[model samples]
Target: MPLLLLVCFTLLLPPSLTAQQRPTTDGPSDPPARNWYHQLGGSVGWARNGNNDFGPAVALGIGAYYHHLRQFGGLVAGAGMGFELMNADREERLASLTALAEYQLGKRALRPLLRLSGGVALPVGSPGQSLDSRRAGALLHPSVGLLLLPPSGQWGAMVLDLGYRFTRVDFAAADNRGGSFEREVSYRRLTLGIATRF
Candidate 1:
């Protein structure tokens, strides 16, 4: 009888100890510390116009950016300025200013992102001497990119962005013949650029 009692106690002892020993898995773990970041980058790409009068063009840009990380994604905002040079016989340049936003995919060292930006484009220098009319207009830009973060260092992260940009310009002027006309110019831009975050 004592042996039977001893065996029963031995079996119950393990379960009781296990019930007390097991750690609760439902509690959340502490999150890592968050940091604010700043980035600067430049881009070069091709630009095309809706009007056939101007041939293909090349564009150059520079920008500054800032963001904060969240659980799933982060909020990104920045400003950029750039110029587009058309292939027209005369010098035709367009200068631009933009505000940007991005939704970052994850908090990992490598993250994928989606971005949207909008701003205005102003005609820079002088309009081509041959042009009838030229004026500044609104711009829309969208892109997908990747962010590569440093493990834990002061060098900052690197970013690569691939996306499309669009802008429209309106014009009204009289030709040398004094015949007046109004027209609109549209630009479709394809661009890729890299930036570093600090």
Candidate 2:
């Protein structure tokens, strides 16, 4: 997250960028308040566990955000919370929530996007019988997507996101044979979502 913030500040603090990218009627994406917006979105994708299909993966998020200065690329940056869950056999498999820092760049509704989030994930339902303990897991997610915005009146737009979710996590536990194991695992997902601006 620090790395993403640094990139934001790098563009924010530069004197040279303060006058180059002003928005006009011809166009670009604005601001402090007029530039601020809120978004809510959900996604569907596939989840995998140990070389097998873990069934469907679902994700959701919501947040209010502000944009950088026009000179600083008028980029949108947001702070929000999101959840990802895995489901299989008509039951919940895993669930997690993570705090996020997000950024998107472009002059119009169709923009490229990137974000990062991290936190611990807990097994859902049966697997959660034991507490995660210190020997638990983490969800370090890095995502990239294309943001497709279509105007809806004046103050907002509809958000359509097509993206890839990179799921990074680890688990530690003792096997039935009295041996313990720790390994990093990943779930790759192709996700799409619809969001609204306010």
Candidate 3:
């Protein structure tokens, strides 16, 4: 019988080569490609408004931003625009436009943001009947910010913001004795800033 079938095929070839060198067939390989939850960053911010102790309380601006990366869990949404230069002593220049929505808790490396903003404020180089008696309208803001990216790279980012604005104006504070005309003027601000992203 061919020498008893060659001794049972040489005892099954050393247990099939030691089960093909076990150790789960040379391990290693279980999801790891760096996506850090879809990276995206861009921002710039600065603001301030100290009610009194002087005019032009505080104002300085520069803005441009975009951030959207979070399918669910640590959400994000953004929009921005700020151009302000309100230096009292009749040097008023203002332009602010913004829209934002955010929520992030990606934990660590400085990332904390919660914001809401509304915009509209224009007044530059007075004239034309003082721009209809110093017209200032449509300004509502809400904010909170701190977002600095680079936990895994993809683009650069940095944002620091604190905001609050409410302004309404209709000049001509007095005209009387025998004339007739009241007054109205209101402007407010509170902002702190820093932003950069690409």
Query: Which parts of model 2 are misplaced by more than 4 Å?
Result: 1-32, 48-73, 93-95, 124-136, 150-153, 166-186
Quick one: RMSD of model 1?
17.2
Model 1 regions more than 4 Å off: 1-38, 47-73, 86-90, 126-134, 171-183
Ranking under lDDT, best-scoring first?
Answer: 1, 2, 3
lDDT of 1 by residue, 1-198 (tens): 332443344344543232223343322211224444555666665664334446644443333333332333376776666666633443445677777788775444455677787888865534533445568799887887776655443256778887777778765655547676665667676767688776
- How many angstroms is residue 164 displaced in model 2 relative to the true structure, after the best TM-score fit? 3.5
Which ten contiguous residues of candidate 1 have the minimum total lDDT? 23-32
What's the TM-score of every candidate structure? 0.58, 0.50, 0.25
| lDDT of candidate model 3 versus the reference | 0.46
Q: Which is the leading candidate under lDDT?
A: 1
Give candidate 3's error at residue 177 in angstroms.
25
Encode model 3's per-residue lDDT on 75-180: one tens digit a residue: 5544455555444444455555555556654343344566566656655433312332445567675656666544333345566656655555444322325443
CA lDDT of every candidate: 0.59, 0.48, 0.46
Query: Model 2, residue 196: displacement in angstroms?
Result: 2.4
Error of 2 at 143 (Å): 3.2
lDDT of 2 at 190: 60
Q: Residue 98 in candidate 2 has what lDDT?
A: 55
Ranking by TM-score: 1, 2, 3
